[model samples]
Structures are given as structure tokens and as C-alpha cells.
Target chain A: MFGPFRLTNPLSGGLLWKIPWRLSRHQKYRQRERLRKVDSIVATLDTALARQGESMRKLVRWKAEMPTEEEMLPKDKYTVFDRKVKRYRKAIHKLPKWTRVSQRLNPPGF
Target chain B: MPYFRITLMRSGIGLPEKTQGVLKALGLRKRMTTVYHPVTSSVAGQIMRIKELVDVKEVGTALNKKQMREARRPAPGYYVERRGTAELEPPQ
Candidate 1:
């Protein structure tokens, strides 16, 4: 039943209101790029400190904890290992500040 | 002493108050604002807390506010070949 008083296209309905469970290909690509950028920044800091014959323990731990971009599998890159989710995993983009924060590592054997 | 050159790259909007407080403690009030502190365990811990939002580098020396500002300032496009009119030779 088309309402005579309404002036709207049905196609416009639900066009942009959905939050997809999974990320788009473009989002995945960008996420990977962001991870690499963070990595390089850390490496730069490390090398700079190395030149000064000093280092931070936290940086050393971070390097050991997180996997590099090349080290990550596509599955792990697009999704993070989570224990609470039904299948023990969730899309990385589901996390808050996903683009701005680093969440590359998961608990052991998750 | 070596220093940590920390530059805030992301806004702390929607984050926890404690996190925002850390940003303030580091003197990072706005995005792209940089502050330098001597490289120490305490400063490193502060950095670890907000690593996701900053770009850090270690330098041999720390830069004060004025030095950092001067470093960012661009070279003057025009120089005085002869001093300005007020200081120029009088009526000659």
C-alpha cells in the first residue's frame, strides 16, 4: 500500500543505517596500512634510541609481543582472536578506536 | 641524556578520562602537538599508555618549546637587501 502523502523513495530506506558484521575490502587494506605505519614508527624510535646506546624495556616487550605485518595471516589481519565471541573471534573493526589503537596480539592459542 | 620526542597524532575524544589525563600530563593538548621529555622508565610508561595515539622518536637532546617552534617555522621568503625605509639613509 503506497501512502499518497509520503514523498520518499523506498530505495533510500536502510541504505546507510546498517553496521556490517565484517569489514569491507577497502577497510581491511587500510587497517593493514595503519598497522604497518605504527610498526615503522616504533622501529624508528628503537633505532634512534639504539644510536644513543639506550633503550626502553617497554618497546622491547612490544616488539616481542606483536607480530609484524608480513608475519600476520590474512585471517588474523582482518579479525582479532577473542575469547567471549561465539566462535572465539570477531572482526577487528568491531573494537573501539580500531583505526587509532593497536590490537594486533591475542592470548595464547585463542 | 636522550629524550623521547612525543607527538600526539590522534585526538583523545571518547577515550577514558585517565587516558586524557595522560595526554595532558605529557603536555599533548592537541593533535600534532609535540613534547620532549628525557628518556626514562617513567616517561616510557606514559608513552606505553598512549602509544596508539602518538608518534615517538628518541633524540640525543630534548627540544624546548621555543626551539621546537623555531624548527617548525619556515624560512623567511624575502630578506632585506637594504634595511626598511624607516631605518634607511635619511633623504640621501
Candidate 2:
């Protein structure tokens, strides 16, 4: 009878036996801590952008030391910056977002 | 128990409604929404339904969206422990 069963079977591995394995690899313990760190950094950037508002453009130009792109952006939320050029472009986008929140930050200005 | 790290590589768009529904149910709204679920028959079925649209790998623990994103992001590889700007300032 498999009534109200909680079967425990030791799992076997295929490859990569060098790496340690876990038994009850639940999300609550292992993942949440790493997620919290990433979320905090992104939220910090978002807050900085929200406070800077319109002055964000000049701030980005200063940090990047480059002219801003005049073209309109596509309607995509995710952008991967693989090179220094793309990083500059993405910094242009992040400027407004970071500056808008930067105004509220009392940190020593750069 | 190992969890599966499912990343949607191809879009489920223009696919059958049932297949699309499976993707939606997995919290995969776009081409790269990586979701983690415990290794169970139900999750397996979901993955099997849209297997062609995704790249699956079994990990020891489930990784959240942010953690997964950070994991895939390349390292910055540099840090500043001291500032030279203060050294340039005039003495009071």
C-alpha cells in the first residue's frame, strides 16, 4: 500500500562526481541568500536612478566619457553588454534609472 | 534531492496553445526566464511538454531568477580598496 507515502530513494549520479551532492536540496536554504544579494544590488541601482531624474544624462556622459546615442531603443527589457561599447550604451540607459534615485542618496558625490 | 534548472532558449510563440500554456505555467514569459523546481514527476511532465523549447540541466538546488542571472553574468574581476583622490587634496 502506497498510502500517504514519503519514499526516500538515494539518487545516483551520471557524471561530475567530483562535486559534492546534497540530499534535500530545498530552495529555502540554498538559493534565497544568493538571490537576496543580487536583488539588493539591482534595487540599489534602481533607487539611485529614480532620484537623479533628468540630470541623469549628464551624469552618465561624465562617467562614461562619451557622447550619448541619439537613436530610440527597442522595446526589450533585457540587454547583454558583452563589450566595452555595449557597456557604454547600457550605461547610458542605466543613467536615468540610477540618477533618478541618486538624488535621494546622501553619499559623497563623485 | 536535485532540482532542475530549466531555461527557455526558444520562444514558445506560434506553438500550440497547450505547449504555450505549459511554458506560461512554468513562469517562463520570455525567451530566458530560468525557473527552478524540485525534481518531481509533475515538474518533469511540464518540462517534457515543452522540452524542445528549453535547455534543461539538473542541479543540486533550485536557483532563483536573480541568482541564476548573476551566475550567468561574467565577473567584474577588479576592485578598489583605497582612494587616491584624497591624496591630491591640499593640506588645511
Candidate 3:
């Protein structure tokens, strides 16, 4: 036989006591996450720059050894040949202006 | 609170009048019309009412009415940096 000192409903408010604490901890967790993202971005950018420098060096060596397009491509009789040449000339004409604008908008290493 | 992105995937034709009414209430005049609304129990309940006819997803913020309308518009693809001053100014 058991003696009951107090009577209470099985459902109680204590179940949700940690909700506010969890909410504030989650907020702190999000802040820490944002800072971690910024740190990762900086590290990634540094590694990217290093890779770009190495690639540029290889590009310079390849350009010195590569044959010119005129030397590589043979002139054969084809229906679209004339049209291709005209398009190539037009592209070459626009190249200077394109280079100038591209340089201004997106500088080297960007 | 976040916003909900609701897009009508299917039509409410031949369904019950109440279901069609819910679609009309959502301002979905036609298929593939996207609308943004703040996430609330009432809105959620309305979506549930016609859940079969639409797709729903939660977004960070609800777009303004004009922006929501513009969201469905196609891109112009080209821009004019300069135009004739006479054309820009209205004729006297």
C-alpha cells in the first residue's frame, strides 16, 4: 500500500523547459557557422590564387611551343570555308575592344 | 516567419465546388501560376485543402505583389547602354 502526499496531472510544463535554452544555443551555433564560412572562403581564395599562378606559368611555356593556327590548319576546298574565314576576320576585328572592356571589368587573377 | 512558394501544378476542373473555390481564393487563375504568402496556419490549411492540385515549398521571405508577378516574366537578354537623347526625351 502506498500513501499519496500530492496529486498532480501526468502532463506537465517541465517537458518544454529546455526549448528557450535550445533556441538561444541554436542562434549562437548559426553565428559560429557564418564566421566559419568566411574563414573557409579566405582559405579557398588563397589556394585558388596559388593554382592560378602555376597554371599561368605552364600556359606561357605551352604558347612558346605551340604552332600557329595558320601553320596547323590546311586550306582544303569546302563549302563553308569562305564563311568561316569571314566570321574569323569579324571576330578578330572585335577582339581589341573586347579585350579592353574585359580587362576593365575583370582584372587579372579575378 | 518564412514565406511559402505555392505553384499550381494541376487544374481543379471537375473537382468539387469547394476545392475550386479554394483555388480561386489562392488567386491561382491558371496553371503554373506561382504565388508567395507568409507561412501561417490559415495559409497552410488552405494549401492542404487543395494540396493535390499544387506544389508548396517554404522560402525565406515573401516577394511583393509586383515582384511575384514579375518573377514569371521572361528575361530581356540584352540591354542598351546608350540611346539617342531626342528619343529619350518626349516630343514637345
Candidate 4:
């Protein structure tokens, strides 16, 4: 009687135990995928920073070519340029903080 | 009221269906999406189910979607300083 009961137990070596094992394996795979995504976000942000830097340089060049401060481009144009520069600087400052946050969440070798 | 600031740091892909359901219930449809809920045991339990996939913070106030986006935005770097057409005229 004991032998038969032991054979039927879910914890006993059988197909039933595979369910939890499979579930855990899937979880691990998902975790890895998520970690990879964090890295991808960091990479894309780096490229964004490079692109923003180029645009900022172009804006500075245009500003330098102007004859005088009073004769600078229209107010709207100046505002737009200022906005872009501010956005770029803000992104540059924020990206590092985001990277650090992500790193803390997943950690290296995690 | 105190709130939990939950940001999805990871996706639920390839995970068990139930785990994915928990994320959806939390209103986290994509990575980096954040949501806030008042501190409660029910919400805490939901968070625990997917705790590995999110970063949680406690805050005194919750920010709406627009405020959250603006918080991430940067400021403009320069001011007009001054504006006048007379300065452009030829010196007399």
C-alpha cells in the first residue's frame, strides 16, 4: 500500500513534478529577456545623445554666424533653438541616472 | 496618502500566463511604464507576484501621466537676453 501511494504522489519522480520545473524555467528565460531589454535601452539612449550633440553644435554654429545679439533671429526661432539645446542637455543629464537605475534593478552578472 | 511608485523595468514575455496577468492587472503594458496605487495589502500582493520585474518606490504624492513626462523633460538652455532692431541699423 505504501509503495503504491508513494508512486502516485505528485512530489514523487513523475510527470506531475515537471509542471513547476517548466514554469520556473520559463520565468528564468523571461528574466533574461528583460535584462537584455535594459541593455538595449541604454544603447539607444547613447545614440540619441550623439544625435542631440550634433544638432546642438549646428544650432551654436548658426547663432555664431549672426551679426549681433540684437539682430539675432526672430524670437520664435531663438526660442526653438533654446528649447532644443535645453532638451538635449536634459536628456544627457537624465540618461546616466536612468542607466544607473536600470543597473541597480538588474545588476551586472544578474 | 502614501503611494507605491511602480515602474516596469522588465517585460513579461515568455513568462507564465498568470504572471503576465498580474502585470496587466497592475496596468503595466510596456517597459518603463509607471503606475501608482495607494498603499494596500491587495496592491502589495499584486506587486509581489511580479516584484522581480519592477522597481518600486514609496512616495507621498503620485504624479499623473503628463506630469511624469514633463518631469523627464529638460529645460531650455538660454534666454533671448534682449531683442531690438535699432541695434542692427548702421552706426551714424
Task: Report the C-alpha lDDT of model 4 over B1-92, residue by residue, as the tens digit.
Answer: 66778889868887778989999999999999999987655665576567557777767799999999999999878888677887898899
In the range B9-85, model 3's lDDT, one tens digit per residue, is 77777767888898899888889988877655566557656654666766777787798779879989999888788
**lDDT score of residue B22 within candidate 1:** 98
Model-by-model DockQ, in order: 0.34, 0.01, 0.01, 0.01
lDDT of 4 by residue, A11-110 (tens): 5665564232112445434434544544443333333334434223432342354223233232211122223453322221123222222222111231
Give the poorly placed runs of model 1, Cα more than 4 Å off: A1-17, A83-86, B74-76, B84-92
Error of 2 at B75 (Å): 2.4
Candidate 1, B30-53: lDDT as tens digits: 999989888666777787778778
Locate the minimum summed-lDDT window of 10 residues in model 4 chain A: A99-108
User: Which pairs of residues have clashing backbones in candidate 3?
Assistant: none
What is the C-alpha lDDT profile of model 2 across B1-92, one tens digit per residue?
56667778778777678988998898899988788876555665576566546766666777776887798898799898889999999999
For candidate 2, what is the lDDT?
0.49
- Candidate 4 residue runs with Cα over 4 Å from true position: A1-110, B79-92
What lDDT score is found at residue A20 in candidate 4? Answer: 29
Top-scoring candidate (lDDT): 1
Check candidate 1 and list the clashing pairs. Answer: none
> Whose DockQ is greatest here?
1
